[model samples]
Target chain A: MSDTTDLPAPSLDVEGWTCPAPLRDRPRVVMGHGGGGALSAELVQQIFAPSYGGEALSQMGDAAVLSLGGARLAFSTDSYVVRPLFFPGGSIGDLAVNGTVNDLAMSGARAAYLSCGFILEEGVELDTVTRVAEALGAAARTAGVEVATGDTKVVEAGHGDGIYLNTAGIGVVPAGVDLRPQRVVPGDVVIVSGAIGVHGVAIMSVREGLEFGVEIESDCAALGGLVEAMLAVTPDLHVLRDPTRGGLAASLNEIAAASGAGVVIRERDVPVPPAVANACAILGLDPMYIANEGKLVAFVPREHADAVLAAMRAHPLGTDAAIIGEAVDSHPGMLVARTGLGGTRVVDLPLGEQLPRIC
Target chain B: MSDTTDLPAPSLDVEGWTCPAPLRDRPRVVMGHGGGGALSAELVQQIFAPSYGGEALSQMGDAAVLSLGGARLAFSTDSYVVRPLFFPGGSIGDLAVNGTVNDLAMSGARAAYLSCGFILEEGVELDTVTRVAEALGAAARTAGVEVATGDTKVVEAGHGDGIYLNTAGIGVVPAGVDLRPQRVVPGDVVIVSGAIGVHGVAIMSVREGLEFGVEIESDCAALGGLVEAMLAVTPDLHVLRDPTRGGLAASLNEIAAASGAGVVIRERDVPVPPAVANACAILGLDPMYIANEGKLVAFVPREHADAVLAAMRAHPLGTDAAIIGEAVDSHPGMLVARTGLGGTRVVDLPLGEQLPRIC
Candidate 1:
């Protein structure tokens, strides 16, 4: 009974729980942390921890809760803000669902659920909201995911875009599989799933009023099934990335940066459909830096490359799979493309915004 | 040995999973579901659950996560776009943190974590972003929470106010304590932590060009500490709410709606600092509906009312505590104010946005 009074002597309990040191180290924010390196980890450790910390958050895994009963799950979130909501081939709605599902698929996950948050301008017509939401629902159905949990907020007519969406998705990744960026190796063959510049050209055509009588709509579609098909055929697939915001060049550069290796591609082997190459030539937008929504770049061991390509080609989602390049030990940290005329040029991360909000 | 070979295959293995059944029960976008009744429950069942099915999400609890852990945590989110970014006592920054933290604290959860999303105008100043971020940090530090995860995106200059903040926060709610709007009962004593209208008047003064030349500021601060202190003395505290946005009017009305009971207030017992009252009068704003930031209106059991009041008064954060109202069984779903002249008027919910975006 006497010990029961010891139950937390209030002030003593507070002192015991209070942070041992003053919080001077935890400055609320500094932009340096967004850089993909050391400072980011420190920021997550100090700031994100104490506030949102709990058992679930403590694991610090790429995708938490591994090896669960029966089903394996993968969850991820992404926010898209394409300046021109309506592009030649698609709208922001199509891009949002596709982008989210693709993220889940990259982890070898079958997308199952999505939650959408929409911020709308006060004067946005109910019809327009209806159209966008309809498109989003259709895209989710096509991607085989359900749109769950939605919230809507209206701002003064001028305070926001007609609409902006942030979507979070959850999916199931199978057992006996692991897909990570660090898996790329020296002899891995890189594959480009399809034409790249079409999506970018479609947006540019609409944005800058560049006319292409033959409409090349933005090629936006969820790639989960395609990825799953490829993974089922070859789980050894090393890296998976969809060049969306930043095109092929940017994706390659990011991979090179991550793997600390060099990448070189034969210009002729890469499958840039004639129409897209012609459009890139006319718009002066490099085909390599042009975005693609319905495509993915993968690296697999050479022994399994043809099987993966055959497997990709067999699937309706991946008809034009091409082995475009291979990871090399030389010319580290750079991307070089061999010309059809036997000339070579270096490709690096674009120094400026190539196409702002071309999601 | 094996039942494995003898077991029949499950129906949803792979091929069957590809075919989708056309779901027909849910509305495309109906207004009735938002009506807060039977339809809403159906919307939750047919549409929400099939997609978002999970233990916690399925609970359909008042606030999410019926049980996060033994460590009490409060989680809430709100968006602010008061026409003006800067007002007298506070700015969007002050309202953002205080509003979310107070909501978490309302549930006896000590405000702990905050996530901020900024939608900035394209041409908005770098300095403005820095200042707002700094103000947000200051407010969080003062509230004893951390700014955890954040996202930033710039829209076309005209697409947004100079700044708009959407804050989602999480806090800890202790064991052996429970507080909800439904906890209000007849004979319960209502307590107003301080003079109302500081925040509301501050915004109105700036927005309407009223010369309260005396420079009145908003009483915006995290109320978790004061609430903890008060709750320490009276764990039976009934209802706790920060009368923001819709002001005391909205807050009380919400409690009435939640409790299915009536509320009556003595006008004389309600304290409004002269400046705020004058500002409200000059601006044609009702003090009852004018928001207060640093202030909160609470209800406590009659037996422990004095202890709660003394505890509140002892905290510098809550110096002007007062008994302003009580719960009543008559006139369910009604809020009435006893006029200084002994008359009564229904305190109705705001028909529409007040001080639009006044947070």
Candidate 2:
């Protein structure tokens, strides 16, 4: 009846879907799956981990800690697709560099070399690519890493938006430093490097044409130096996370799940820049759930918390560092906030990030 | 005149163009630039190397050889944008794995780990994505490498064509087995692992709806094991190359340019399958310019040539291997082909590949 003989048969066996079949629900990829939230985590754990089974994957860290020829190395990769290639304070180039560098730094590793892959659309200007390259080179200099090997591929117009960058970094983790979420304990103090929600707001302003009188620059910078400074004070730092997509709320929830520990933070003590707060108010956005680029959250032993804070404050990138929370023994695998009005509320990880591709 | 008061100034300083300014006349990217030809080389040497300057980049090879903690490592990356997603015998996933693994293998390195970065379109089917992941996992297992770390990004609809995959690999180069184009000498013999033009013809057949009675499978297999097989016979292999994108003609030209020597290949001796020859005749395509994935071209000393060829022919993947040419001292930095008609023709690198996205 439908000329079925002319049509081809289906390729895949849809009846046998098992990995994350029930949890994901959607048969098509949604924007939120790339938002770095519960969907992102589920996609990673259920789909990717099961497909690519390896011992190193069992340990969930910012970068894979690999033993190669009697040396410890950290390898991590991140893709940058932030719209409006150039934002207020940084462009996609610097974001690509800082993002991968921050990932390696989260493992207390000093990034040494990086590999960059570029996917460009046809008709993209050569001058724009050159400018992006210049920005990338400058950022690599600041991060103390070399862009060693790279690849470039182009798609026909309409298949891409200007360019997308993927940077994979290799770094050496110092011998004494052993950092992971599993090391978090009940007596650990929670510290944030600086104010949250600046990077996301900066991108939103330009893309949405919502200027807030004063220009909001992205807090995009390499945190390798700041991380090294903290490690100098103590190599026993328990956990380090960069609140990029889904912001600090997602980071806290991830740590709680990974470490199987309870986390409680004081809302008033969390630093939110005045401009960011105003932007969030206008956007009806919660600052805690917005993304950050250069900031980091650290969980350290209570005994070394004061010293770590002092060391972080001494660094230029961490001048606004503040201790806002602590790991708790009760209510394991949960995160809560002490509200400004003397109330407590659960801060659960969203099914998906409020904003997508903030990085 | 045009209500331009609210518009901001352009960001990049186009007036300050320096690297290969006059040579690369085009200000916009064309498909040919990514065709693995002279334009691609010019883009990398002029634009990327100058921006990301380092001593390591001065040595151009399939991969960058780095010394870290007294261990020699080979690092390389490749991006796949092949259309149709799936072909006769291989998909983009296997191409992604085998391509990077081959790059490391060309450097006489055994690939150990890989990092995959996927850029997915917003509405891409999850089933398609799952199938790709499964193919990738299967390929990694076959290559004896692990997909250690990965990143995924989703773009809005109309901004992407299904998906693009980028893989960066790390491998350990065995001691005393140095491989580089500069090491090629006048007396070296040129040996190709198998027949040429199968991969390009396979992809073209599907894209153009050409039927040769029988489906031509893509020769997309990992070459790390093949390289190891050759190394077992002799560690003195001078140079190795996989003729992907630009084919054997491009590879010969590049080797000549890098070694500053002349190459002479016999047309009759170069193995071309009958089906590929027929397809080329129908399409008016040069078999020499077509791409290959699994085949490799090796330059070995005259004394060790027989042993290496024997080893290659003994392997299942290289049963059709043959010695097609030899390096010559005349006409340095040029490639000459001896035709079946008993005449010689100059083989220069094309401005771009005859077929784009054949990989």
What lDDT score belongs to each candidate, Candidate 1 first? 0.66, 0.85
State fnat for each of the candidate structures.
0.07, 0.58
lDDT of 2 by residue, A1-359 (tens): 24552232221111121122344456667666677776677778778788875887667677888887666888888888889999999999999999999999999998888988888877787888888988999999998999888888877767888988999988889988888989999989999999998999899899989987688999999999999999999899998999998789989999999899999999999999888889988877788888899999999999999999999999999999999999999899999999999999988776565666677
Pick by DockQ: which candidate is best? 2
lDDT of 2 by residue, B15-130 (tens): 22112223245667766667776767877887888888687666667788888756788888888889879998899999999999999999999999898888888767777888
Residue-level lDDT tens digits of model 1 in A27-96: 2222222222222334345544543334433433222322222345555554556757887667888887
- Model 2 ranges with Cα > 4 A deviation: A1-24, B1-23
TM-score for the first chain of model 1? 0.80
What fraction of the reference structure's interface contacts does model 2 contain?
A: 0.58
- Looking at the true structure's interface, with contacts defined as alpha carbon pairs within 8 Å between chains A and B, what fraction does model 1 recover? 0.07
User: Candidate 2, residue B87: CA error in Å?
Assistant: 0.8
